[model samples]
Target: MNKTICALAAATLATGAAASEPIAVTAPGPQGDLAGTLIEPAEGKPVVLIVPGSGPTDRDGNNPMGVNASSYRLLAEALSQRGIGSLRIDKRGMFESRAAIPDPNDVTISAYAEDVSAWISVVRARTEVDCVFVLGHSEGGLVALEAGQKSDDLCGILLVASVGRPLGDTLREQLQSNPANAVVLDEAFAAIAKLEAGEGVDTQDMHRGLMPLFNPAVQGFLIDMFARIPAELAAGVEVPMLIVAGGKDIQTPVTDAEALAEGQPAAKLIVIDDMNHVLKPVEGDSRLANIATYSDASLPVHPELVDAIASFLEDSKS
Candidate 1:
């Protein structure tokens, strides 16, 4: 794993009669060092690795690109409150993990899967647990599936608002679903096509508003990601699996979770009502409200989402 323990301890959080320390943790990455937070209830207790989604999302599940919802952070807190341990990590080259790599855009899905494996080993070593559960949200679920193929130590996998089909298909659906993206729909689809075909899309003519998403720097990585099918990976998983989707999620719909469960018929699927992509509760069927939750960091994630994850982890351990 090449993990170096420079652990800094923090006060323990009460979770029922038990409590766990929130410790700063790190592991070696291909380019540098990966950083994360580890909350351990006790040695040998089942732990979860909270893998963040796409873009510049950090270990806390908040990104500067208008996504400040602390999805991962809240999930970790909720799990800890139930006496479950968890590790939420920053991808190499972002936020506290910025120094882990020279450039984030130079990475691929396989690299991320490898990082997951490293994290699994590091977490097990540090917590003295035999295995760890992986809870991957959105794009991170794909990484979890790939990492599962590489390691037998994983206790199970939880896919939250993750895709079951190829990324190109989901990208198209998401772009077309939003009227505000209508102006850039054609350009976005064209770029996605090029990336899916393993080619680079020139961004010189791309709309300035879409540059952050389709910039040349990230094209190579996007091309690699677009090639991996999450369903195919899920189908090959031999470990316990759970797929959670939000009924009101605008980004990745409940159907995606259905497809994942279909791919792996043994997997348990749970669809939470009013839960959005950011894990926050959204009212009615308002897309505006759903999207607004992305920026509201203070909003608590749907309680059902946490309950589902904690229950799944407990069952996995048994």
Candidate 2:
């Protein structure tokens, strides 16, 4: 946690474009249908697909886990200002995407990749751009990487806070580093190991003592979750990429972004000095309030965060 990174994420926010008229669209999803808004540049410009992160997260980069800054919305607005079009959407069975699936947790990275394709189809039909770039945060970054591998129409990939190392490895490191609970540390490790092996540990079983680690829904994702590193996946991609990490991001450290960038032949890396996971500027190494700002809509995300992505996107076009 970088004490000086109080403005890391705040630098990436777009404060002006939220009031603009954003184009809205709803596309068919695996479980049901997803609702989305496409914010295009007034002058007509290339578009980006705003991929949502994990666990009931909305198109706005918000989640039921407490993030509500509408980070993705701010990002889209910022991109619009840069003359780049963007499409943000609700995940399957959440908010407007509620109809996309029968059960929200029944989704995995592959499903998300499918959703990206669906959104791309919609973007192509309406916009003149030949392909849309993918901007994925955290878990969403993995989805974007997967999609980029297959989507020939993909313009490029922009990964923010994406898991560069295998998720299982990151989980182990987090557990070892966190001072929270010593009791569940080994249990959590065992469960993660099982999930990594593509085995299911009953979240209900006590002797196994790995419930939260192996929830039925998330387990399926974990089967493939910790399997690949985002950098390795993006390494083979021909699309241009920009990888940004915050100096103080406790969830996914700046090193994670560096590792991903390393795997690629020519990807740019911009490490903000003091940005947190939520793009907020933190005053100290204490991550105590990091989760708190996720709900702070009035707070401005770090400008550098947005600049890094926008700069990379613009540079790629050049």
Candidate 3:
């Protein structure tokens, strides 16, 4: 990987302990600048790179579309309190890196997988950890898997709310499950058809055959990536692995996590009770109420979720 020539969006500071303030750093990306938080470890501890799920989400896990849950930041703090450090990054040309691009939607998993390796090089230089752990949430789990495929800098991989099977299959299932989107179900089916054909769905004007959830650029990436499953990638990695899922997770369900462990002999799977897709507890069956928790920073992620990951990382070190 070529060394990135960068101008600091946030300056790198003296490293010793994990500071309360997350240092801003720019790493190499597919299009424009990619921003990240180089979360230093307290006492120069090992750092984990918390990869955000697929979206236009920033390093802190918040998106402009109204997802304000500081998932990444909170996770970093929880890990830091456990003496585990991490780096959280915005996807290429998103948020702070938005100025780094002309078109933001033209990105693929391969590009993101490359960026992960590049960030590891930049992050490891500033950390005291012998290796960094990758904590991938939702689609970011795919990025973590691909990154481990390329480099050995990872200490271990903790797949949080990741997909177990082919993503194409999962999306098709979700299209059928979401009632609000029932009318557009045919569009979902047609979109999948185009993707399966390895052809791009023409999105000149958002047609009835297109879902806003799948942009042309992102759809291209997903089609290529869905062909690559977490288990298929995990099949080659020998590092310590932890596959976590919330019992009620609507996105990447626990079955997916189970499928991942089935692919890797060494993986340990944990299904947390009362936890939903975002790692929050929800009452009753209202999917809307369940999704509402994604915005509540006041609520702690199921303590079990953090505990499971921390225990794995700590045990790996020992």
Candidate 4:
């Protein structure tokens, strides 16, 4: 454990906001160990497990897909300041958890939900807490919802920048939102339709840019994702939920949060104006300007987001 702590210390030091040393922790995985960083808050403070969003994102919230923003790491640090502990993990078959499975793309939402259950068990044992909060960002919110359906150990759920509709609908809107995608809009829409129908699409001769999104290796996962309607899942989650939306977010807009709140009338919803998809504040409506923040690790996550989450957790306890 000391070696693990030493190895991960530099990364934690970079955050410069964690109240204590970050401990490298592991949860059981299918074939190997799932890796995470656990930052314990002041004694008896509540703990949260930060689930990464889609893609090959690491525990720190950075990925090779042009996203360098350390959103999760910063969020963990900020929460620590609020006396909240956090454990942010690398998904199976990616980054430090690469050995957890043979392939990263061979996955489904259910599998991710199972991993969340495993992580919950681990956090409870380590922290000696009755339960832990689950904070899922973007696509991860879907995983959290699925996990909450069967897991009895969750304190509550926090959905951050998550989509409220089926992934296919969201993908369609995303494609249609950009004028540059006009050339491939028809094909992309067709592919999404097929996936939503539980069928696969032939990507042969497809646009090069579209291939990355619809690659055959990940088609099965897409099919599973398309089948899930986040609103429906939110309706099934019996635990307390906090849905946070960014007003300036282009990906999953405020409408999605509203939909989630509608699905679960008891859930609390918070909207942070000026926050972008990556959780950074964007002053204007420039799409390019908003995207530029995805690569800027120096930019802090929206203060309002941190405040809402901290307050929600505190309130959930009472």
- The best candidate by lDDT is 4
State each model's CA lDDT, in order: 0.84, 0.76, 0.76, 0.88
lDDT of 3 by residue, 1-318 (tens): 224343222223454223345677777665556777775665535778888887777787777777777878888877766666678987776776665566667666777777788778887776645878888889899888887786567778889989888877888898788677777777777777778667777666655445476676577676787678778998877788888988888787778988899899798888886788777777787888888988888877777887887778768878
Q: Write the per-residue lDDT of candidate 1 for residues 164-199, one digit (tens) a residue.
A: 888999989978887899999988888899899999
| TM-score quality measure for candidate 3 | 0.87
Per-model RMSD to reference? 3.1, 7.2, 4.9, 3.6
How well is each residue in 1-318 modelled by candidate 2, as lDDT tens digits?
112111111122354332235766877787567788887543435788988877778878787777898888887777776666789978777788877777777777778888889889888886667658898888888999998888587888888888898888888998788676577787788788887887887666444434555667667777877777777798877888888888888889887888898888588788888887767666677656676667887777788887787677667777
Number of the candidate with higher TM-score, 2 or 4:
4
Top candidate (TM-score): 4
TM-score comparison, 1 vs 3, better candidate: 1
**Model 4 / residue 172 / CA error / Å:** 0.6
- Model 1 RMSD in angstroms: 3.1
What is the Cα-based TM-score of model 2? Answer: 0.88
Q: In model 3, how many backbone clashes occur? A: 4
Off by over 4 Å in 2: 1-19, 207-210
